[model samples]
Every structure is written in structure tokens, then in C-alpha cells.
Target: MESQPESHLLKLRKDTKENVRKIYNLDKPGRLEEAIKILQHWIQKQDHILKKDWNADYLDKTLIASKGSVEKAKKQIDRLCTMKTLIPKFFEVINVKKELPTILDLAMVMPLPTQTEEYYRVILVKIDTKEIKPEFFMMYFQYCLSVAEYIKTHDYANGFILVYDCRELNLAEVITKISTVELQQFITLLIEGYGARLKGIHIVSESKAIEMLINIVKQFLSEKVGNRIHVQRSIEDLPKVVPKGILPVEYGGNEKSIKELQEEWLEAITSEEHMEHLKVMYKACTDETRRNAGKFNEEYMGMPGSFRNLSVD
Candidate 1:
């Protein structure tokens, strides 16, 4: 039979090597450094391969071993056969130029995939590494881009939709009195401008937008910690996490500022009329139910209603 494919031969040869085997010897004596070095090499190889072949990826692959019999596994695989998601095949440690035996590091992960992909690449490193740090947001956007790109190229074949995921992100506390006008400037750019490559952005999460707003409201919130905020801003507030100096071309009257957006938001959120309209009902517990609750004696709870359990008391 013809020799195994060049890739298979490469794999087999490496599998036979002592250095390659060291990658898996995490607990072996004197192998920790080797394992780290190997993993780093693997990541470098992935980077190189991605930059080399347009259709090849270097992410590790996975095996699906179900608890069911072979038939079930086969059926499961068949079901997934139609899925559009890329399946990771397995991982390998490719050799890198002599770095260091003491270079073994762990915890940082290197991945390999079955096929090469066009993932979303954000240019936020420049901004993040500078100021108004978004914290792990670039990575989130990276993943979002990957999923969005995969769906776009695989499913739509060529179309656009307003794709944004704004589930949540931690709101960083900022100086209470400082004007976030600079940051708002950045938000305009983010919403209006595209990503690094100017390619169509199919997905953009709005979490950072929320984060910035939190920063803007820090001033108001400072007055009442733990109390609910009565937002006086309009619902269409501009983002507050924007970088120092950048604004989108699209603003009210084709001209606006962070202050204006904040004002609009204030109008929407703080209007006394709006507050009354926006009821925070507790499902309207019936008056009869309230009376019943009062009738429940201390025996049911096995405790006195006002025994003053505080340590001081």
C-alpha cells in the first residue's frame, strides 16, 4: 500500500520520540518543564500553521465516547455529521527551535481544530493595552466572531444581520465625579465603526456598552450604596467605556456629545411619570393572602417574630 499520508507519517514519527512523549508526562520526574515547553511549542506550531495554510487549523481534536454501545456512538456521530460546527480532531506537540527545557509551563491552553477557520479578530489590543481596559472582552469578542463567522459563511453563504450578544459583563467602578465623555467618544466608534479588517461584522456583543454606562453612573450611585438607582437618563444613552478620543459619525442631528446621550438617558429613566408607568409589581399578592401570612403563628416558623436575635441586642 502507498505510504501513509505525509501528515500521518509526521505524526507517527513524533509519537515515537522521547521529547514528544514528555509532553504528556505531566507528573513524571523532571518532566514538568518539558511538558510546558512542549505545550508552548504546540501553540507556536498552531500559529504558524494557521498563518501558512488557508484551509488548515492546528487546534486539538476530541473523541466522543458515549456510554452507550457502538451503535449509539455511531448514531450520535451520524447525527452530528450534519452539524456545521467544526469538530476538533486531536492535539499534537510540534517541535520548536531550542527554547528551554526549564520552559515548561502549564495552565495556558493550546487548541487544535479539524479545519482552518476565519475567526473574528479585534484590534482592541492596541486600545486595551493602552487605557479604558475592557478586561477579557477582546477574548469574548474573538469567540463571538468565530461563531458568527462560522454561521455566516456556512449557513447564510453571504448575508448580514444585526448580531449582538449583551448578556452581561462586570461593571468596573471608576472615579465618581470624572466626566466619561472621553469614553463615550469611544463607544460611538465601536458601534459605528467595523472591526480591525473593515470586514463586515456579523456579531458584536454590547456588554462593554453596559459596562461603560455603569462607569458613568458611578457618580450617582456613590450617593446611595446598596439602594436602587433611579436612572434619570434616556434609554438611548451612549456607551461610557469608549476609548479616550474617538467618535462615530452617526449622532443626533448628525452632531452630539456624551453629555447629550446621558441627558436623554436621564430623561427616560428619571421622569417621575415614567417611574409610575414602569411598575415594579410583586405579582400583586392578594390582600387575603397578606392577611393569611400574618395569621401564620410563630409555631409554623418555630421562632418568635421579634425576639431580637442580634448579637448586640
Candidate 2:
């Protein structure tokens, strides 16, 4: 995969880089570079990985996401490639313009341009229409992953804060349409496959049924992650968790409106350069035949391939 040009990449604040390094215990001289080298060597040795030539920046992000553990980074990379190979439905047809318009019309999922004081990138999900469909669950996740792919290459951050604006959402209607199996798969892919370090998840809603939705979501998350979820009775309370300066104007902040940000992100993911990049990335899957039989069974035997008989521990 071609590396995004330096000029196009998001510029990280000098202090943000230093702070993240310190937090991840990668502040020591040559420590981060050494970890990247070790990860690169490990990838080259893995016969199952079809693409061993991963970019340095990609390796760095993987290492950071692993919390400075080279071993965990190794597992993370293997799981990601394995999922890409097994879950063809998610990886196939990544053309944003052709495949995502319907879902985009129902809701907006975009990473805000600014970072919080703690340096966590906030991703805003706004559901505007009451006409929710069952198929939208997958498409919504696919869109989020598309944006994540962009972040993997261009941005630097400590973790992510998800702001889910569901004020207009019909939770009772959505619950009936959702499949528990697919819900588990989406959570797994987000945390395990993509290595998303979720600092927090803020759900903005006034509906009493919001608790029902939260209960369903928590079943798929670890106790620690479940504890990170905060329910907001109003958008006015958002500033207490996510700072005002970074939030969009609609939420009583100084940044651009969510509509504007959504449009900009839509344009970006559908851009010719990014579309070609997604096609190349969708091909970075594992070759199971080349993998060690014992290791493959030990690692992935429990996983539900193609969403058949899915079970989450």
C-alpha cells in the first residue's frame, strides 16, 4: 500500500507526541523505533500474512495501540489480517460513493477535526432519520471502519471517544431489527481487529429506551469498556465529558457544524486516492493454507466465520 504523503498527513502537536510516548512508556530513546523494527521482523516471518511490507507509520500505530507491547501488537496484526480474510462481506465493495450513500443518508459518522485536552480523537455519530433499517447496522460499521482506515494512515492520537447522538433514534424500532450475532461481530472487529482504544462512549439521548439499547451493547463489551459508557440526558451535558472547543457548533461549541464535517469526511473517503487505497487494503488478508494449523485453531477456532453460529465469550 502506498504511504500517504507527509504533506497530506495530519500534523501532530509536539507535546501531543511527547505525551502519548510518555503514556505508552515509549519515551525512552530509540525505544519506539526498536519496537517497530521487532514488529516488522515478526511480520516478515509470518508466512500467513500475504502482505509483509507494512509501512513504518502503520507499524508505529499498531505498536501504540498495543500499549507498547510488541507481543500484543503481533497478535493484533494477525487477528486483523485473519478477520479481513474471513469476513469478506465487510471488506468487499468498499467504494464509498457507490456503497455508502443510503446509510449516509440515515446517519452521519465522522471523526471530528480537533482533539480533546487529553488528546483523544472524538468520533461523532448522528442519527437524523427515524426510518432505521436492519441492514443499516452493517453499513454504519463499514462506514466507521472506512474512516478508521483513513485515521490509521494519516492521524496520531492516544485513543478514541465516541459521541453517539441518538436523540432522534427510535431504540425500540432499532432493537427489533438488530441481530445479536452481527452486533457481537461489529464490536469484536472494532476492538480486536482494528485495535481501537476507546477512552469513552457518550450516548446522547432523551428516550427512556436508551437503557435498553445500552444493555444490549454492554453484553458485547468488557466490564471495563462497559463502565466507560456514559448516558447523557441532553446535548448540553456533552461539554462535561467532551470539551466544548472541540465539539461542533450544533452542540454549543465553536467548531464547524456536524453537517459540514460530515460532508468533508464523505468527500475525503470517496476521493479517488483514498478509494484506490481502500481497494489495496481490502486485499491485505491472510492465507490460511500457509499458516500453522495448530496455531490457527488455537487462535481462531472459537471465532464465528461468516457470522455463522456466532458466540461471544
Candidate 3:
């Protein structure tokens, strides 16, 4: 993989020896090994759908994120694999430079260089309706998956701090451009299928658009996720919850501006090396055989009515 600035990679607040033991059950003589064995057994049952070389590290992270529950880890892995194949529009073969350059500009998704004191990775999102094209929602979904893929290997442990700058977009544009169903799909994928720990979400918007967005989010997200939401009236108010030092200059922080960070990401994701890496990550371990097994739900294949039945499960 191409190297990023040291800051872009996840940095733990402290040594995680105790957390590793607790989350992965490494202290128990056989618990860690048993978890691996269980995942391996489950993989084999899928007819070699998961790559033969799927490493212990990947399964270990899944196990850790599932809070050491083998059953939950199994479900997480299955959901991820099935969704990748089931919804190829988002996961199949993403050529962002060609397919989504416009939507990427409209909804800028990138990680902050600094993490919280508790080691949570901070993700920044700013949606500008002025730049939005008609296909913004689907493209934004692709951008989100790109962000999730980047963090999956890097920031799986400490969870995430999601910061949304809602000032640029208003209620009218939001309600029309970003439908309730589309929002539900995005939230469902992040919370359930992605398997990342979500620490909290902060929405900074002076207008009442914050309430509108929050109400829509509350419809699909669980109380656990809903309660973690912190609404701020303005960008200045963010410092009280998220220290300014960890934010970019665009958000009144000391770091680089959000535009600069977005440009850096744009160049990186469009580059030849990063594009190849994304292709591998997208296609790897996708189980077409499992899909053909006739056990998956076809109704949950794509957006529209697909998300109506999905909760934080």
C-alpha cells in the first residue's frame, strides 16, 4: 500500500496491551486461538469464498470489533462479504477518478490528521449543496465506503469521532438531495456492516437544519447511536467538545484546511497505485459462491426500499 503522512494513520493514545487482552481475549490461554479457529471453520463452510490467505490479523480485528463474540464476528464477516457482492454498484469496482469526481467535491469526506486523547479517529464531512450533482447520494455513498475502507485496517480499535459541517447545506437542499431512505442506507452500512466502533457524532450547523438532519438520522439509528449525537450551533462551539488542535483550519483549528486535506485525498485516491490498491480491497474475499447458495436476501440488495427494513442490526 502507498504510505500516507504519519498523521493520517491512526495513532493510539497509549499502549493497548490491556485493551488487546480484554477485547481479543489474549490473556486466556486458548480463547484467542479458539476465536481464530471458529472464524476459520466458518470460512471453510462457505466453500472457499473468503480467500484462502485471509490472514489472522483481519479475522482478529473483526473479532476485536465484535467485542470478542465469535458469533457476532461471524455475522459481521458474512454481512460484509455478502454486501460487497450483493451491491456491486457501491463495492464492485470503484474508479472514483472517473465515476465520482463531482460528488467527491460536493461531499468532502476525509480523516483529520490528529486523533482524540482517547485515540478515536476523527472523520470530517462537509456537504455543499451548491456543488451537488443529481447523483450525489450514490456517489457520496461510494466516498463513504472509501473512507470506511481506509479506516477499517487503521482505526478499528478505538472507534471514530464523526464531525459533520452542516453550515454549507440548508434544509431545502438537504431534504431534496439527501432523501431519508438514502441516509438510512448510509447509517446502516456504517453502524452494522462496516464493523467499526462509533464513539460519537458531532453536527455543527447554526441553522435549524441540524434538527432536521438529526430527526432523519434518529429514524434509522439505534438509541445507542442517537444518544451519542452532539449538536452544536456553530463551528466555534465545536472546540468545547472536540479540541481545536485536532481539527483543520477550515473548522477554526490549527491543522491544514479541509480543502487541502480533501485535495490530498483526491490526488491519492485517483493515483495509479492507490487505485490498484482500492480495486484489490474491493474485490478481495467477495463470495460469489455464497451469493449463489440461495441464502441471501435479494430485497436488501440496493437503495430505495432496501433500507426500510434495516435498523442498526
Candidate 4:
């Protein structure tokens, strides 16, 4: 007889954590390709669970597979390809180096041998398990159009990924979603300008990436801008936020692991002595802050001056 447990969010989180640990602990992994087989088995298991009227089990199983290896991950996606089935809180762990650059409409990094110009890569990853709806595809299409318009207006050549092909619904009709206002303008101005094979006044083509900048800036300065959004979301650009002359992104200082920071902090700041000594503490806090800031600005952000003059107090 089959057993059933009630559904809960905490259960799903626990299941995901366990699965991620299991995957990370894979012992002397034979080949990366084997991850695909584990994923396929997971897909089958999930399909069977839901078919048996076990929603909670289905969700737990799906979350586990979501964090599996890329091949397994892609197989996990087989259970979720439709826009109608996506649940909003869903998440999948993916490696930035291996998975992201390939699944999108444009490659952010050209393959090794090409002459493509290199530019800073900015990306935003939004994870949702929102029971995927057909309307969601429309939302994605609009977002892509907006991104393209922003890029074009700013003279930036960036790439994007809508990444909603996880639910079990057929994503084929995503075509319908792509026919929004921004894409329409891109077709007329960019595609037609280059005499493209237009799709009857609907659909975005590769050429429309040209207009992403124009639309993005307009929305940023317009009523559409919101507090929740950022132009860049990945921590990859963290070091770059500070001026680069002093601390470089590639330098060992800025890139030091969290363990190293904790060690350094413990070695220097004794609670009693630093607290009692005012001038010594002031010089340590202010001068150290300035030095670190100066290093960060000169080396990471390319700022002209060190941040020594700015007083913390």
C-alpha cells in the first residue's frame, strides 16, 4: 500500500538541502556524463509519484532533482518543461561556467577561437516555482524585449535567458508570448532595417538584441522602475563595485575566502585593548578602512584616488 504525507514548504527545503549535499558528495565521480543517468531516474520517479496523487512527494522529489548535476538537472527539467506547471518558489543549482552561457538566445562569451569583442557580463537569476501559467510565457517575452531595448539604447551587447522551461507544460506556445509591444518595435526598427525574414509582424529575431538597451533605459527612468530591481545581480561584479586602484578583483586580497577574513579579524582586534585605547583604535579603524578602501578602489573599481580621506565616524 502507498503511504501519503501532507505537503509543506519546510519539507521541500529540507529535501533540497539533502539532495544538494548528496550531489556535492559524489565520490570520485567516474564521469560527468553519469549525472545524466541519475537525473533520468529521478525524472521517472517524480513522474510516477505525481501520477499516483502524491503532490507532496512529487514536490519533494522534484526539488531534490533540481539541484542535481547539469545532465541530471536537464533531465529534471523534462518533468517541468511546460509553462503551466511551474511553482513560484522552485530553485535549481547551476554552475555559471558550464550551464548558463549555452542555454540562452545569445552566447555571452564567444567560443574560444572567435573574434567577438569581449564585454562585461551582467546577469540576473530569478528563481521561482510559480505554478507555471501560459501567461507567464508572455511575461517572459516582455521581459526579454525590455532587456533587448535597454541594451540597444545603451549600445550594449548583452545576452539573456528566460529559463522557464522547467514545468511539464509544452513551452512551444512561447511563440505567442513573444508578440508584445517591445518586440514589435524591435522587429520594425532593427530586423526590417537589415531586411530580415520577418515573421508577419510578430516574433523576436536575433537582430532584436540590438534594441535591448534602448528599452531598458527608458523603463529605468520611467514609472516602471522599482526598488526591487538592479541592473546587475550576480556577486561576480562585487569587487568591481569598489574603486579598483587599490584592491583588484583578481587580487588575493579582495578574493580572500571568508575563512581568511575571520582569521585576520581575530588576530588583530582584541576587545579590551582596542576598546580602551581611543587614538590607537581610531587610527586602526580609520586608517585601516582608508587603506583597504584605497586598495579596493584602485585595484577593483579603477577609481583615481584612494578612499583614505573619507571618515567613517
Clash count per candidate: 18, 0, 0, 55
Candidate 3 C-alpha lDDT tens digits along 1-313: 1222332444454544345556456658777778888888887777626555556767777777787888888778766665665455676456676877777656888787666656567888888764444477787888778767766655545567888887777655666677665566566667667776778899877776667767777878778888899887788888888878878886778988887888877765666765676677676555454444334445244433453344321
* lDDT of model number 4: 0.27
- Over 9-32, each residue of candidate 2 has an lDDT whose tens digit, in order, gives 233555777788789999899999
What TM-score would every model get versus the actual structure?
0.17, 0.93, 0.82, 0.20
Worst 10 residues of 4 by lDDT: 107-116
Better of 2 and 4 by TM-score: 2
Candidate 4: lDDT of 15? 37
What lDDT tens digits, residue by residue, belong to model 1 across residues 251-284?
Answer: 1122234344323323432344333322221111
Residue range with the least summed lDDT across 10 consecutive positions in model 1: 55-64
**Candidate that would win on TM-score:** 2
Cand. 2 TM to true fold: 0.93
Identify the candidate with maximal lDDT.
Answer: 2
